[model samples]
Target: QAAERLRLSARTMHRMLRVARTIADLAGAADIATPHLSEALGYRGIALAGTRDAA
Candidate 1:
């Protein structure tokens, strides 16, 4: 919803680290680790949300 609300492309919005940071915070992570980054990227597209979509 943030992507559409912000009028941002799914791809572009997906790459945004801001989303990752938020996810990390929600997960109570002390730092934005690789897992957090990967999880954040998952919400971007269907192709990688389940599979693998490395940036």
Candidate 2:
């Protein structure tokens, strides 16, 4: 659903997962949770803000 909403490619989705995993690791989480994924998406949004890709 997020991938569809963001129109993310497979590569981009994989990158997001990597970021989410890192976030989880930093939090001492054994696995990526919804919050980590949400945070990753929020960061992606922030990074894209004011850019042509921002929606």
Largest TM-score belongs to which candidate? 2
Q: Residue 45 error for model 2, in Å? A: 0.5
**Structural similarity to truth (TM-score) of each candidate:** 0.50, 0.82
Q: What is model 1's C-alpha RMSD? A: 8.6
Q: Please report the TM-score between candidate 2 and the true structure.
A: 0.82
- Tell me the tens digit of each residue's lDDT in model 1 across 1-55: 6567767686776576787888889989878887776676567666545566454
Q: Model 1 scores what on Cα lDDT?
A: 0.72
Candidate that scores best on lDDT: 2
What would the per-residue lDDT of candidate 2 be over residues 12-55, giving only the tens digit for each residue? 89989999999999999999999999999898887878585655
RMSD of 2: 3.0
After superposition, the stretches of candidate 1 with alpha carbons farther than 4 Å from their true spots are 1-15, 47-55
